[model samples]
Target chain A: MGNTKKNDRRDFLSKFGTAFIAGAALSPLISNASELLETENNVTEIKNFKGSFEDLLGGDYTNIKLRMQDDVRRALKKPMKDRKWAMAIDLRKCVGCNACTVACIAENALPPGVVYRPVIKEEIGTYPNVSKINLPKPCMQCDEPPCVDVCPVEATWKREDGIVVIDYEACIGCRYCMTACPYEHRMFDFGEKYSDGLPLVANYDKRPSFEYGKEWDREDRHSSPIGNVRKCTFCAHRLDEGLLPQCLTTCIGGANYFGDLNDEDSVIAKLVSRLNVFRLKEEMGTEPNVYYIR
Target chain B: MKKIFYILWGIAFILGCIGVAQRFMYGHELANYGNRVVWGLWVAMYIYFIGLSAGAFLLSSLVYVFKIKMFEKVGKLALITALVTLLCALLSIWFDLGHMWRAYEVITRPNLPHSMMAWMIWLYSAYFLLLVLETLYAFRIESGKYDGDKLKSYQKKLGILATIGIPLAIAFHGGVGALFGVVAANPMWHSALTPIFFLVGAIASGSALFTLIFAFFWDNKKGEYYQNMLKTLAKIVLVAVLFDVLLEWAELSIALWMGSPEHTAGFRAMLFGQYWYVFWIFHLLFGVVIPVWILATKKNGIAIGWASLLVAFTFIGVRLNIVVPGLIGEKIPGEASAYIQPRLTYNYFPSMMEWLVGIFIVAFGIGLFYLGNKYFKLTKENNSVKS
Candidate 1:
């Protein structure tokens, strides 16, 4: 029985080879037919899903997180002066899911009353004809930050990479910076807790946030950040590690985009070129790094 | 009457101690001022007291620099009041700081040319020293420490000191106004008129307070000299009140006329929002209307004293109006409803703790004033040194 089966397979292969050669010599259509037939035969060897390997290798994947991660890695290769980090948010793609806000809270270990990002919802027109817009606000990180100049202690400043950062240690928590910020992005850490009324505070609740590449324990009442004016840093710690910002990665609808604006080939640079792009309170002359695509 | 005042002081002092304990333990957790309205009752109180100090000191210049004899008896009292109020203003603001210990940073490592607050700090320090020196010089003459030629020389020294103090006082108080005025983000405070208005308000409030103190506590109130002093003080306050009202009207009418919502929002809020009564009731009714009526209608020291007291006490409402309205709105069109977190909203009213702390600072100032008045021989009649 084994000898007969081997002879039968050899006969089938010889016939298939003759047909494949004839199809390739005949026309493009026939050549495509032969290729599809061969692919079908290759699929028979797998007992599960077809085209899984081609789907991986075929370059059809368009995951924003992966694209942004690659963009960040490329950005890391450039010097700080050459890397103008910026963010572009597409309002049309935003579903107001607030995933970015939650992700930021988790990534920064933000306490209650201290939010780095908030999605503002507004209803346009009247009742039946109304439409809604969700605007997610973060720190503008202005080029000419009013908050920077108004700081009596020089606790906060603009970085070379265009991110406005606060030195929690030096901040007097006067909230003058808070008042100076037209966007009202700076928040005072009122030393509140998310687990205030709980039976016992969880260990995760006490986890120190690693902001500016330094671990900060909030348990000590006399510590720095507790009395400091706090705001978003655009996930600077993660960027230092060649990773995308938590908000960008956790964006549910891929509405948030971040990359080096200095890079001519970056996604943010491309989006910012569009006519629909704008910044909040542009008249105030803050010259914000964050842009929006309506 | 003295017993009643002492009783009131004791009650407030005890209540203030409780608030102080809460403040140290909780650290602004009990205060109603949030991230949006970062300043509240204490901040308003600071500017109020500072204005009072500036006004009183400026009025004292009338006696020292201008050599106005009608105001001579109250010059020492005004100086002492200025010092006491200045200390209270500093204390109120100090407690408002998140890290009260780091206040020295503003002095030690300040962004000098950039921050109005830094300039205010330096100017106030100079003003403080000048005030102490001026008070000592005036006390030297009043206490009969020097005779004839020496006395005249000490008076000359006071005149010189007061001359220097006039500009310093204006700079420091105007610096306070400029502190808020420099913030271009808040359109209500960004006006060039803000500092000018503060100077006028300080004069009005300070002169009103000086009038009250002189009328009620000047030791000799039944004489022709007393009546003349009271008459002159009332006239100064009346002129100041009228000038302050004119400036306030100009500020409001111009802003309202501009038709820009950003410019008018704060003014409108002051006039018609939830706390409209703060402007119309507390400030206009008690601070302006009643005082204006009494000063205009009556000519007696007792009437002017009570009316001046009303204006001086109710000016806190005016200060609050200046502060809260500038901060009580959304930056963006819908920013007010954007977030639902504690202190992230526009609605702000001082919590009980804030009120207690504010009351405590005032009570503390009153106690200091009482002690200073009783023991320092600050009054004209008590100017003699103990043998």
Candidate 2:
């Protein structure tokens, strides 16, 4: 009975889309009349499937997106104190496409030399026996962030939700945090532009990055962030808006996962409990929220 | 000779003006130091000048705090050198700052105890205040402002100031080293010996510089008193240099002894990689070996002056060696090749603008010294001010 109900809704949505396209064709003013229409029973077949793109491609995924969306909605229902956000990256699945890196840049409007996520490519063994490993690094957002304690002005701190954030206005750009960070995730903005050699600064290059949900313009040299140290905040702004982090959503291999770790049933919680999971620089005792599965 | 010196100073001043203009007009965009190697020539120079100031101030305390009469004549000179170098050191760091104006936040709203740099700034401020008061009392004593009882009281106050300054100078310079040492991420600088190394290096370089000034610029160079002072200062510099060499050897050999890849990579880069000449040619030969040779063999003031000048100038190389090597290696192997950008590379050299700014700082210091000598009566006893 449940399966039939899902199919009915999926079929109804596809029919509605076709009708809308047909209706638009009757009006000469409508543009791209053919491409606007989508015809596929994949939606109908996977109506019960949640969010992962595997659902569209007929893979037997647990519907990670749908489960995560539900998980997000459920977690949001609880007070902020009960939430502990975490990220898990499965190294075996990552192909080093760097799509997540580019998506993060676009989402954050990061300038040149200010990379928040960089995929480290390494090869093990010798000659023909060699195997490639791609590790994507982001700010650890450690429970005891070394970068936080070294800050001379207390400009950066770990949020209650487990994201380490910087107050750009308060940061003095001493680069102490940059040196203290073992992972070297922090970047100092020297007011460089991607639009160098262009006749003018490109409009897109000048667009404000909405980090921490605050619009920051990079037009001026003396602006808060232009001379401040910057790092990843786990896409905190997107998390608050019921969206998974941009990097997780854009990972082509579905290697990355993020959710509230406080929920025992969440994907991240289950992943963290696995023995294969590990963190970078574990001996440093930073207790980072981001974990990797070997 | 004087005219030629003036001309050279003029040329340097104008060139430095261009660099300073570019710095303010464009910001660090012109500097080659990127995110990975975040500091460069200016930072090295800052530490170098601060080392000079601390070393010279500590030497002056021998006259006031310890009452070593053999060092009496150069006490005022050492004080002035400390003050001037402190200014230059502060300026170098200010220019290096990404936000030059926000530096006061370190004082106004410091995150104390947690930040080593905050402690450094506060200690330097206290040291600066003490220095100024100490200089005033020293001048008042020489300016003939009081009778026997009053003069004795002034001397007592100066002694107290110098005694207080001993710890301030040690803390400030040690704090400079601690600033780098506390960075656990960079294995090259993470050591208990770092602060001790910095303190000893400051004494070595600073005393060498003071000895040179006394040898070359003292008015009564032909007198027996002058010759005796020059000999004693040279001996002091020699001892400091020997101590500094011992520390340098300890730092180098310990890192490279076991051939541990992680521990020795930065040292290897300093010794064998590009710009290796900075450590070998500029520092080892010109800074240490030659100065040590001249100070040991020659009793003449002129020879000591020449040798001490070489040590003083080439100490910049020592400063650079300390800073750049620690940042040369990648934290993770192959990390440098992972991302390719001008500002992302493990390799670094100061940009042309960086060199020009450094030249300007040196020229500015020389010009200030010249003015102080001529008008402030820095080299004269009981000379009246023109005003």
Candidate 3:
């Protein structure tokens, strides 16, 4: 249903854009005809009246008409906000299954030796009286992001809807962002591929944004120049279609919660208020958007 | 003479090309680096070369601004060295950048308020311009054709410019050091003294590089002016080395006294862990200690020249110690600090392509230097007033 709405919007934008251009091209002809009509009526005094030429034309001057139409088109084409995308990981409910990590790899079709998410195991106390804890780690998506600061080319930036994004095309693989990230979230695109299971999958053709919406394309995936850095974008492709992140959806123990903190009424926000939520490296003042409830 | 130089240049060019090819093909995996040790030899080399440039430029200021007759013979050479080393430093960073093409965008659309890297871009560009203008002025004076009126006016203008440049040179290198030091998350590098340490190291290494290069150029022909220039430069090098050592000791002692586990871990990594040999043996013993001893004890001209060579080589080691050890440990282990040993066992052997490109840059710098010297008559005879 959401896809149909988006398609309708896209269609409206395409037609509007075409009409705006056509209107701009025909404005002079319309003005000339109006002038001819005025001359035929012997209305020479109309030319001397002091008002904008646009007002004189009395219909629509092409530039302003096109501009208004373009604005409408842009508004229609703006990305939908149905999925106020969020993630919740309940540490108390988690088991050390490592299922989410495996799921993320499978879903993302990650390159060999690259794991987008990893489960970290920590043991506390002496050997005899020790308790083990499993923590699933993903990109923190910090509010005051350090990675964005040190990106020399401004390739990585924060989106208005509160997600950090990597413009892979613009990133010059300097990895300064990797160095700056205290969370150790960023990864270098070494142009590695997984060719073992399905050799042809390694050669999967990449489609443009219109086709696959920045998911996976053989030509465009890591082809963003090898030296550029990359990190998780909270599954923007899935989020666009009102779906939860793969890790969040596939968690075996249901440990993660994803939602909008901005909405006071959101379930995640209510849960966060009730539980003692924490973020990693809070002392660094990065103010990560991801919250953890122990 | 030109043929021999060209042949040597060609060889260096071929080797650098191979190194670059390997770097591109293997994705810096060929270099001795990993997640834990993200920075390695290239970063060290970058800092080292920048330090050398700053040092040489500072020394040139002595001749140009302070009117130091004893160091006049090598002023133009120092300027040329400054230019070349800066180029080399820039190239090192270029190869280090994962996305080399988007480097320009760093300038066009810079992130302000919180970006140290952005500041570095602006600072480096300004510093490069200052060096170019100062060097041009130095060349003009090196030409004997400078009439009395022009000579006085040029010196006055250059002296004023050099005064401003000295602080800028200090800041450029110090700023680079602070780039790493300001990252509070990196317990190894975050320090108030990091900028000061960088400045001292730049001066020390710069002096060492100049002493070595000056001696080599001097060997081509002997002159009283050249001898005096060497003695003065040797003295400057001695002072710089002592200050550098003192700062290093102070920095290390403070780190030990603070006794933070992470800080201690970083220091120990340098003193005894993976980087011990490079830090203790090459950086301390060869770079600082032996050179200090040689400079103090050596009386013969030949001995001093050899000491200068040792100093130059050891300074390279010092740069490695500064860059590598700080980046070897992890704030968060296992997850954060992935093992990043260079694919090649020795950690680094710049592939043939890398060497070829590196040497080509060097050759270009040398060619410029030679032209500057030949056309401008950059000899002490050209520097004198008839009165």
Model 2 docking grade: medium
TM-score of chain A of each: 0.78, 0.79, 0.64
Expressed as tens digits, the lDDT of each residue in B69-109 for candidate 2 is: 76676687899899888988988998988788888888888
Q: Could you give candidate 3's per-residue lDDT for residues B146-168 as a string of tens digits?
A: 86999878777778888888888
Off by over 4 Å in 3: A1-86, A106-109, A196-201, A204-225, A274-276, B1-10, B24-32, B146-153, B219-222, B336-387
- Local accuracy by lDDT, each model: 0.83, 0.83, 0.65
Q: DockQ (Cα-based) per candidate?
A: 0.50, 0.56, 0.21
Candidate 3, A1-294: lDDT as tens digits = 122234553343334333333443554677652333243222332233232323423343332222222332333244534223345565654665677777676666554444557666776888656555677778888888878877666778877656788886777776667778887666665545445346464343222222124543435332563455666767666655555567765554546666565554344555566446787889999888777777
Q: Model 3's CAPRI class? A: incorrect
Better of 1 and 3 by DockQ: 1
By DockQ, the better pick of 1 and 2 is 2
Off by over 4 Å in 2: A1-62, A77-81, B381-387
Q: What is the interface RMSD of each candidate, in Å?
A: 1.1, 1.0, 3.9
Tens-digit lDDT track for model 1 on B39-100? Answer: 88998999999999999999989888888766777788899999999999999999888888
Best candidate according to TM-score: 2
